[model samples]
Target: MNLDLLLEQVRSTSLLEWIAVTFGVSEVLLAKRNKVWLYPTGIISICCGAIVLIQAKLYAETILNAYYLGMSIYGWIKWKSRNQFGTPKITSSDSMDKVKTWGIVLIGWVVLYLFLINFTDSDVPIIDSLVSSTAWAGMWLLANRKVENWIWLNISNAIAIPLLFYKGLFMFGLLTVFLFVIAVLGYFDWRKILKEENNELQSV
Candidate 1:
């Protein structure tokens, strides 16, 4: 793709895709900063993504995005709920939560892969399932404001970048790279926030 052709495609991009990308970028940046606004922004991004993926016949991705929609709503509710003392703080996943996250990845991968192999005519079932499953687990952790969500999300982003480029989606590949960097930063930032929260608790 030459520079002129890429610019043409950018100009030709659907309004919905532009909206999706715009909200998606905002969502990730807010998430990196541990802002509650990410969920609402992400809900819009995920909805637009699902519509775009459905039009492209990417059924698995569409479903994954629908899952994100539900999780985003759930996350929004969870994030907004505060106790009387108003102390809903950032935290790391406990041992049980860690086990559940891994379980989601492994089982989700198998179920999605089998669904694709048995039902859909998808050409890239394995990698697609891996990416979606990891993201599914990551979204679950993110809904609960877990620090490890960034780790799981980045795993999906790393796999997805090459896959998107392989499918000739250079724009999406670049977007995933941006997301990968933000997730790395979000991980460390969350760790720092978690430490501060723990210290604050200790002082009381």
Candidate 2:
């Protein structure tokens, strides 16, 4: 199958939208396998997302996408390191102290909500915050290799799909729906990996 056909769907869409979706799918695939390279893929999507949302006149999403770009850079650096083979492997999972994990989650959601509410006048204020916050948490969890990130991704997709479709981004919205299904499978897959790793460590 000529995957090039996918580009046709993008033809009617802006370049940024196409770029964002392509890279977003790539990021999700890389993330499913716990690859550190997901960060760069995410960065590509984030940059394009910012542009696409801005062009579409969705200022709040535009800003969030910019923030995503910045976060991607940080995540990339944090994940890059040598694995058992001394090859560059992004962290599959890390021991995040419970206190720090909750702290970051709390602070991130609060800040994202407050910023959106105060800075934007969209009728779907809470919905916007919900998607952005969920995505931020998911991204952070993904950076740490937490299996829980897929849960957040699923939540974000639920909100994003309708929102994008309503906003006239049919292609982007459809993509989010596809992502949601993929994420569900990813959750189970990652959980299995984590369990196997834990069992191996216990045996060792």
Candidate 3:
């Protein structure tokens, strides 16, 4: 297979699409490095994605993309203000906090599913809702510099791959497939970075 063909397809995109892809690719790299700037980059990417999807007539995904744009903006501001000097301070939490966060995420997913069912006419409303809610949680957690965001990201991309294909976005489906693999690798990479940071702190 010619990888150049794939690159050409993406390269032929409109200006907004180009910006969207650039920001998205940057977000992925920044996310792997646990950088705070990823949130703002995400906002630009999602805004572009929303335009592309809406034009393509994938209403459910279009709405989700719009939501992502708003989410990225909110997350960017939140993350920027959360820590001193705008740097994420990696820290461990107790079991109770972890349980509470997970519980909240589960409940939020269920509620979001119900909400989408009431508002959207999509046949795959449940799956759509699940993906949106989970991705929202992942974005929120990432904004807070939480380690578990990777898990939610992995789950979201897992669902999104087939969903995009079903919606006839062959290129987007391929993109999500790539994202899924990257998310898995990102999980381990961030974990290792975190451990290394901890060890260096101990040594000092």
* Candidate maximizing TM-score: 1
Q: Please give, for residues 1-204, the per-residue lDDT of candidate 2 as tens digits.
A: 256755655567877787888888888888777777888888888887887776665665666677677777877776775567553332243455345545655676677667767876566666666777677777666666677778876887898888987787867887798799889988998888877877876899
Q: What is the lDDT of candidate 2?
A: 0.73
Model 1 Cα lDDT, one tens digit per residue, 108-148: 99999899899988888999889999999999999998899
Instruction: Give candidate 2's root-mean-square deviation (CA, Å).
Output: 4.8
Among all candidates shown, the one with the greatest lDDT: 1
The regions of model 1 sitting more than 4 angstroms off are none
Deviating ranges (above 4 Å) for candidate 2: 1-11, 83-114
Native-to-model Cα distance after best TM-score fit, residue 91 in candidate 3, in Å? 3.7
User: Which residue pairs show collisions in model 3?
Assistant: none
Q: Backbone collision count in every prediction?
A: 0, 0, 0
lDDT of 1: 0.87
Reference-based lDDT, each prediction = 0.87, 0.73, 0.71
The candidate, 1 or 3, that scores higher on TM-score is: 1
Looking at model 1, residue 77 earns an lDDT score of 90
